[model samples]
Target: MPRIAEARDAAAPSSTEQHARVGRILEAAAELAAENELERVQMNEVAKSAGVAVATLYRYFPSKTHLFVAVMLDQIDRMREKFARRTRPESSARDAVHDTLLQVVRALLRRPLLSAAMIQSNSMAKAAAVPDTARVDRNFRQLLYDAAGIERVTERDAALLRLLVHSVFGIIQSCLNGRITVPDAESDLRELCDLLLAEWPDSFTPAG
Candidate 1:
């Protein structure tokens, strides 16, 4: 029993350490991408900043795009965590969802470089057929699900959320591409959110 207990304790730290190492690498990549374009970031520099060997970095993230995609995935996880603990505004579900998504858009647009890098990374992942891209898709779908104020999603709910997410993605990209002003984009999106989510339960609140 003592031997089994010792093994479990030892294995726990290994898992924690793995998570820590990955966090450090992602942080380094984010910091580097903050100061440079996505194409400008190099893996060697990230490894140096992360205090890991270049080969170690490559083992975790085989390419620059994979690193950026993982960074973006981490960011989305953070956003979900934030929303999970936040208070629901005392408004209709539509209004609350509108406000939630508007806040997310404003925050993301503040770091246009990082946002573009994330988009680029996802595109590269898709083109390269990176397995992690599937995880990104799942997380993104969850983001939309949470935004729609559904604690438990059904197929119909998921389908609606998927459409809403795609719409939001297209609008945000349009804003990024300079085809739409930020203010216009925000207004248009909020309006669309209000319209589409009008039928959502008025009693619904953020899960937190």
Candidate 2:
């Protein structure tokens, strides 16, 4: 008999069942990564933990990199929802943006192993090879723009935000690598937000 093989496509899930299965796979991968280094994580274990066949897992995630990148995407979605629920209208654009980024940093620090895996995958991903990688960047930018209260984005605003985001990611990588402490990272992020958003309409407000 001819050998059978599953399609090796890491496309986004379409059906409800597929979405649920994908969610389970992400959850399983995240749990495993949290407990061990990325290099130690095994695909077969993730599939067994997720209750999906090995081939099925590969259908959604062609490689460990793709799996973890999707996990980062899932994290972004959760962050957006959390921000919406809190709805801090009292905060200025700079404060909101700073707080949001800090939240992200702290969340990652809480799960160092898993965060390392996700960040490594995200950094390694190429736009052509992992299309969801672009989705991660676009969604994160939108989150920052929303925090900035920028209903309409301008060329200058976009450019500044892009630089600010890149700087923040660098800080995160440094913190993860133990090159900087969390307090220092927090201070650095605050300074960057202040400097980058100085021109933003509501970046600073007079204290009572």
Every model's TM-score: 0.83, 0.91
lDDT by residue for model 2 (1-208), tens? 1111222337678999999999999999999999999989999999999999999988888888788888998989888888878757777788889988999889999999999888888887776777778888888988887776777777997899889878988898899999999999999999999999887776433333
lDDT of 1 by residue, 25-54 (tens): 989988888777877888889999999899
lDDT assessment of candidate 2: 0.84
For candidate 2, what is the TM-score? Answer: 0.91
* Runs with alpha carbons beyond 4 Å of true place in candidate 1: 1-14, 204-208
Can you list the residue pairs that collide in candidate 2?
none
User: Candidates' lDDT values, in order?
Assistant: 0.72, 0.84
Cα distance off (Å), candidate 1, residue 143? 3.3
Give the per-residue Cα lDDT of candidate 1 at 148: 52
